[model samples]
Each structure stands twice: as C-alpha cells, then as structure tokens.
Target: MNSDTRPLPQFAHAPLLLLIIAFLMMQPLSTDLYLASLPTLSSDFKVPLSTVQLTLSLFVIGFGSAQLVIGPLSDRYGRRPVLLWGLALYAVGSVLCGLAPSIELLILARFLQAVGCCSAVMIARAIVRDAYDPVHSVKVIARASTWLSLAPLLAPILGSYLQVAFGWRAAFAVHTLLSVSLLLLTFLRLPETNLHKNPGATNFAGLSHSFRLVLGSREFWAYALPGALSYGSIFAFISGASIVLIQVLHVPTAYFGYCFAIGVSGYLSGTLVCRRLLSRLGATATFRIGSAISLGAGTLFLAAVLAGFAHWSVMVAAMFLTLSAHGINFPIGQSGAVSPFPRQAGTAAGLMGALSMLVAFIVGSIVGATHNGTLYPLGLVVCALGLSIFAATRLLAPAEAAA
Candidate 1:
C-alpha cells in the first residue's frame, strides 16, 4: 500500500500508540474525576463550596498556562523525556492531593496535577502528527478521542462509588496509580517527534515567527474557534449542571450521575458515528451534520423548559443529544486545526489546546459566577453558544448548504 493511501486500522496493539492514548484519555479523567468529590472535599476541609470550586478553575488556568511553556520545551527537547517528567510530577501531585490536609493544599495539588496532565495532552497530539500524514493523524486522533470519551462517561459514577466506598482521597489514589503507569510507559516507549529541532529556532525570532505562521492563517480560526466555543459549552455544563440537576430539578444526588452519564452516552455515540464517517465524509460534512443536530438539541431544550417539560427524563434526553453533538464535532474541529502543521505539530497542538482551554476558562468562570438554582442560565449560554457555532461555521464556509 502507498504510505498515505493505506486503509485505516481500527485496532492496534502498537504499545506506544496505546500508551499515548491512555495518557491522553487520562487527562480528561483527572478533570472529571474530581467533580463528584468536590462536595466531600469541601466538607472534609471545612471550606465553603465556592472555595472548593476555585480548585477546578485554578487547575484549568494552570493546565492552560503550562502548555504554552511545555510545548516549546518539548519541541526543543523530545516528547519522551518531557512526558516522563510530566507524568512523574503528576504522580507526585496526585500523592499530594491524596494527602492534602487542607482545602488550600488540595487546590494547590490540583494545580500541580494540571501542570503535569497538560503535558500528556499536548505531546500525545504532537506525537500523532509526527507518526502519520494529516489525514491518518486525524483518524488516529479520532480513535484516541473515542477512548478518551470514557472518562466523562464513567468518571462521575465511579467517583461517586469510590467516594462512598472509600473517600475523596481514593479519587486521588486512582490518579496516582494511572499517573505512575503513564510515567513508566513514557520511559519505555514514547518517541521523539520534533523533526525540525534546529537550535536556531529556539530563539525569540523563531518563536515569534511561529505565532506569525499560526495567526496568519484564517484556517486556524475557521476550524479552531467554532469548536472551541462549542467545547466551551461543555465546560459551561460542567460548571453549572450540578446544581441545575441535583438542586433545581430535584433529582437525587446519586441519580445526578445518571444525568451526567446520559450526556456522555450522546457524546460516545457521536464519537462512534464520527469515527465511522470521518474518512468517508470530510471534516466540514461531519461538522455540518453534527452542529445542526446540536443546534436542534439546544433549541429543543429551551422549548422543553418553556413548555414545562422539565421532567428528569426530558432534561436528560435533551442534554444527551446536545453533548452527543459535541462528541461528533470536537474531534473533527480538532483534527482540522492540528492536521495542517505536520512539522510543527507540537507547537500547533500547543496553540490549539492553549487557546481552547483559555476559552473554556473564560466560559467556565462566567458559569461559576452566574450560577443560580435554575437551568435557564446554563441553557441560555448553550443556546448562544450553539448560535455562535452556527455563525462561525457558516462564515467559515459560506456555502455550507451548497457544499
């Protein structure tokens, strides 16, 4: 088979590929795993609920900020050493989190954990770009995301079970074990992907020039911004849905996890559908279908609420469709953004992750602030986000219907 024209493999025992996917999947797990435990953490530390929420925001800020620095460092050095070191630090942070005696310390540990987890996420994407052509790279990323979606799917239920079975500290213990595994895997098999690792490009001019290359491309915004905004909506849900489901909607606390899992089921289905159709249907086609469904879902949600169809089942079903749309679109848009710069994949990924997380941070912060005991605030943001996504895509490809 010609190198670029080969059929995509749906399964691989390639140890390096498995290891990288594991680490990438784990990043989201770290973010999601703590969600169910946040209340217990607050009670344990004698802190207010909002103070505990700060850890979530703080970890996001650190995770996003660290990528800007880590990407360049990995580019200069190699993916393996960087990943190993980051995983090592992540393990240490996880231990600290498990042992943290106070809320402040727990928040600090979470930030440190983010600083480490961000490395896996950025490097995993970069390494994929290094291993395959842009198209194949995207397929691989889609497969990776398919696995990663499990974190959100299973984390809440698992976290709740663990918290009840053991304690909040068990969540961090889970973190520590996986962190160590990734660290060892990196040491054993992670390959270097910086093909153009010339010493000269390490200077200020080269770095500035990297920004120029990325910024100069309208393609970046066309692909990145829509998906970023849509992805940010997920973050909005993460920040707001706890109260909306458990408090406002009068769902039991334990059952709230099922609500979260319902959304994840949508995402998983979207991921599966996207993966199946990705190579056959182009990114734009995939996005158009997914976004339309998502927009419809969001509108249906608003209509349901207004019509007083706010039964738990109704809410769960609407959210399921909405999040499934996210699953369909997230990987497609991400593939569009990172597939362009094969040589500078680390920098490419770094830029995308950094900006995407920054957007999520802003949206998440707003959700945290505007949170009331109702779903209106969250639903409004999702609707606006859906509309914004439709506008961005239409602007990006004005001939969407024609295409």
Candidate 2:
C-alpha cells in the first residue's frame, strides 16, 4: 500500500483497525441490542407500542443532530478529546437509561446516549478520512462495515437472551460497560489523526461556510441521497420488525433474533462482496449495482405484501436482500460524499450522517404511526424509498459520468 493509504504511523494497523471497528460497532450495538426488549419496555412503562417506538425515533434525531456539532468541534479541537468526552457521556446516559423508571425518562436517556454515541460514529469516519486517501478509505470503511454488521448479527440474539433472563435493563448495563471500556481504550490507544485541524472551523462563520460548501456540492447529494434512502428503508424494518414479526406474523420472541440475524448475514455477505468488487468494478459501478439490488428487493417485498404472503419468512428474505444492498452502498456513498472535501472531512462525514439519520427518523416515525397490525406500512415505505433510490441514481448518472 502507498504510505498515504496506510493508517497513521504511530499506531499499528491491526490495533488501530480494531479500535475503529469497535467505534463503528457502538451505534448498531446500542440500538439493535435492545430491539428485542421494545415490547417489554412497552409493558414495563404501561405505554402503547407507538410511544415506546418514539424512543428510537428520538435517538435518531438526537444522534443525527449531535453529529452536526461534534464534527465541527472535532475539526476545531481534535478527534481524541471529542471522542473521549462522547464516550464518557454515553456511559453516563446508558447508566441512566438502565435505571429509568418511566418511559419519559428512558426516552430522554436514550437521546442522550445517542448524542454521545454519534461522536464515535461520525469521528470514526473522519479518522478514516484523516488517515488515508479516498481509495484506501473506501476499502477500510468496507472492512469496518463488515465488522460493524456483526453487531446486529449478534446483538438481537444476545439481547433476546438478556431480555429473557435478566430483563431489558441488562442491555443498557452492557452498553455502559462497553462505553467505559471504549473510552479508556480511546484515551490510551487512539492518536490525533486530525493533523490539519483548523482551529477557526469552530467559529460560526467558518462552520456556516463549511456547511454551505458541503451542502452545495452536487456530487455529494448525488452520491448521498440514494444511500440515505437505502438506509432509511433498512431502518424502517429495524423500527418495526419486532412488531411485525412477534405480533403480526406470530414468530416466537426467542426465535425472532435468529430470523433477524439472517438479514444481518446478508449485509455481512454484501460487505464482504463489496470489498472484493471495489477493486475490480470501482465505486460508481458497485454503487449502481447495490441500488439496483435494493430497488429489486423492495419491489419483490411490496409484491409479496400485496399478494398477502406477509409471512415471517417473506419479511426476513426481503430484509436480507435490502440490507445486503445497504451493505454494498453505504461505504461507497460515504467515501464518495467525503472524497471531494478532504480538508473538511469531519464536516462532510457529519453532514452525511445527519442526512442519513434524518431519513431514518422520518421513516421510523412513519412506521410507528401507520403500523396497523400488518406489514403494509413497512412494505409501502420501503418500496417507495427503493424507487426513490433507483430514480436518484438514474438522474445522477450523467453527472457521475462527467465527473
């Protein structure tokens, strides 16, 4: 590998890679690990299912919004301090969540936890951008994503067991412990990768200009919007899968996690395939392929729903296909979005994350609101989002070719 493509020299690549993967895993672990507990949470707090679901939407909102500030701060101050503080806050938030006595308190704590966890996510991307050039960054991100997907693969299974044995609070307790461990590892191991830190970037004027530049870039929008929609479709399933599977389709709660793991396996397979294909087909071709896969999967899912074959197997199969597409598209979209603004990597990563999470929040809320004891809402939203992804990619083809 070219020196520019390697990780920073002060740290060993293996250890640094592990740390970054750990950082990438936090967000998914935080959310997915407790998915099996949503019904339990609803019962515990004596709230309706929709109210319990708000906790997730709120987390997305807080997590997305926090990245807007954390990214700029990382650019202004340094990655290490921001990461350390974020992890500490995440630990505090997780502890509070574990002890929360009401749905209201739990929602607030989840938001705080999300805000803190967002730092690890956005900053991990920034660090990859900081440490490597665009080409290598994509590969690194793909590998990290493969590792990240494992969280979802295992989290639900582990969470189901926890919920079955120790109750929902155990999940938050685990999150607290993980956060503290990560904080210490970050403090001791992770180095300052923002060698070109712009102290002025924290100022309002500088921040505004950077946001404008990133938001104004046609290329970024072209790359990001489809990926965000794809992500939103997957999150729609995440937000509603438990209800659909456990309540509607009547899958046993214990086995629900195993079925969920099947979808994550698709994502893992896609990322592994993406790693190989990135070298051969390059990002644009690979991205198009992923989008097409998602569109096709969405179409099939809708057709199945329309045909009244909305079984657990059908839902799992559709989710597997859609998530696989996401696995392929996400790293490529992220790499493409940040590639043009190497100097403002933090801002770019943050904005992209914000857009993606905003889409998630919207989709989650929609699913929560429209859920009517069937998979219709999930199918409709996912299919529509997939169509949007396909159209966006087609519309952007000329611009991509010119670039």
Candidate 3:
C-alpha cells in the first residue's frame, strides 16, 4: 500500500477510497439517473427528438470544455477549492434543471450541471495519480469502479420509477439532492491532494505549454484514445437507445430500465473481471484484451442491426458487450494517460477527460442527427467507434512497449 502521500494528512485509506468512489460515481449518476426521462422530455416540450437530444450532447460538450479549465485551475489552486466550487455549481444547476419550464432551459441547465460534474470527475483521477504509482493507480481505479458500477446499474431503474411516479422532473430532483449531499461530504471529509500546485498552470503561456506536452505524448494518446472511443460507442447507445427501444422496437417505457440494467450488468461484470486481469496480466495486456472485445462487439452489433435484427434484445445484447469492454478499458486508459506526468497529473487527467467527452458529444450528436426511425444510425456510429478503438490500440502498442 505505497502512496504518494500528498492527500489529507489524517485520512485513512478506507475513507479516502470511499471518497474516490463517490467522486467518480458522479459521472454515471449525472447522466444515467435521467436517461429514462429523455423521450418523455421530447413529448412534453413538443420538440423533435433531435432537439431534445441536445440535453445530452450539450451536456457532454460542456463537460469536455470545462475540464480544460478546471484541470488547470486545480493544478494552480489545488483540487480542494476547485472541487468545492464545482459541487456548489452542480447543486445549483441541478435545482435549475428540475425547475426548467422549457426544453431549451433544461438543456442549458444540463450544460451548467455538466461543467460542475467535470470537476469531480477529472479531480478524482488526478487524485489517484497523486496518491499512487502507475500500476497501483490502475488497480485502485479498477477497485473503485467495482463500486462505481453500482450507479449505472441502479440509477436507470430508480429513474424509470421516478419518471413514472413523479414525472421527468423527479430525476433532476435526485441530482440536486445527491449533489448537495456530496458537496457537504466533500467539504467535511476530502483533503487537498495537489500539494505541489503549479502557480502558472492556469496562465495562458503555461496552459498552452501544458497542453502541448500532454497532447504531444505518444503514451497519453495510446492509452487515452481507446477509452474515449469505447466511451463514444456507449454514448451512441445512450443517445439512441430510448428511441430505438421504446419507439421502434416497442419496449414498454416502464420495463426500459430493466433492459438498461441488464445491459449495464455487462459493465459491472467487466469491472470485476478487470481487477482480476490487472493482478494477473497487468495494464497493457488487459487493455489489449478490452480493445479486442470492443472491436468484436461493435462489428457484431452493426452486422446484426444491418441484417434487420431490430429486436430490443439485439440492441440490449450489443450494449452489454460494448459496455463490458468499456468497463475494462476506461480506468486503465485514464490512469495510463496521467501516469507519465506526475507533476502535471491534473492537466493530463483533465485533457484525457476532455478528449473522451468531446468524442461522446460528437458521437451523440451524430446519432441524433442521423436518426431515421431505424437502428441504422446507432449501428453505424457504434461500429465506427469500435473500429476507431481498434486502431488506437494498435497505435498505442508500440508506445506501451517502448515504455
């Protein structure tokens, strides 16, 4: 249990681990808990499906863009203050989202919420990099993900019930409650992990140099891009699944969460498996395995969809497989990206997060725009992402070997 030891002085490993889980889980909680409400939002707002879809794409864009600032700020000012302010903003944004009267307002609120959420996410990864060496950080991330999986696993089920009983607004209410609670917990329990704060990290000249160093690294892209592409495939499903299942395949809205849960089970399973794989195979080998799985799953999904298998079961099965791969790749990609730059871990983590969210925004928007009452758009987008993941894996192999 070696640690970098820059964390809160008196904090025990157990409590710190729980805090990490809480911080990282915010990402899934923010999105998954409200997913079941998407179609309802479309109908209630009298907007086209694509218009409603902006709530997601716009959220992703904000999430990505905010990290560019939040990461550097954390490096300059330390993670604690940045994180505290971000949580406060998230709480306010969540309340606004719940009360939004129009679809436009809801999208705006979601974007604001995303900016706040990015701070928790990027800082969590930066904390891991700060506390542990590379291999240990990967294992810690996998362990944390084991618990983090619970959010996506349960949130949709909870959300569907909320959507049915209390309407779509209930989901945002939950977000508001969770954000405030987490904010209190963070203020009380979390400590500043960025002890070696860089005074110039947020300055224009310094920020540009940090960007060039992180982006210029072959190792960062080698590890980061697969996770980003894998996440893009998952976002494709998230963006399109409700329309495909509820509208085209005709699954009942009430049962949609159960279907989603079943698919998320694959991710849970992958996280559990990731822990074992890391112990036996290490990060590089395990990452390769995950990449191959994504390629196969994506190819199969597109093939099945193109061959006219429009059943909800087919889509769910593909979701399961692709997400399983993501569960395996994400932690490793995230950790590996930041491992090289100990002094600049915050900047590196933020940049890596920005890349993934940017990919999600692009993939999600394309899925929305190309929707035509069929599974074609989802299938095409997912398969393309899978191919991209495979390419990234190949590109990263040499870099990993060199390291």
lDDT of all predictions: 0.75, 0.88, 0.87
**Model 1, runs deviating above 4 Å:** 1-14, 398-403
- Report the C-alpha displacement of residue 293, candidate 3, in angstroms: 0.3
- Which pairs in model 3 have colliding backbones? none
List model 2 lDDT by residue over 101-180, tens digit each: 89999999999999899999999989888876666888988888998899999999999889899999999999999999
Cα lDDT tens digits, model 3, 246-271, are 88899888888889889888888888
Each prediction's TM-score versus the true structure: 0.92, 0.97, 0.96
Which whole-number lDDT from 0 to 100 does residue 269 have in model 3?
Answer: 88
Best by TM-score: 2
RMSD of each: 3.0, 1.7, 2.1
Clashing pairs in 1: 266-324
Off by over 4 Å in 3: 1-14, 399-403
Residue 223, candidate 1: Cα error in Å is: 1.3
lDDT of 3: 0.87
What lDDT score is found at residue 196 in candidate 2? 85
For each candidate, how many residue pairs have backbone atoms clashing (under 3 Å)?
A: 1, 0, 0
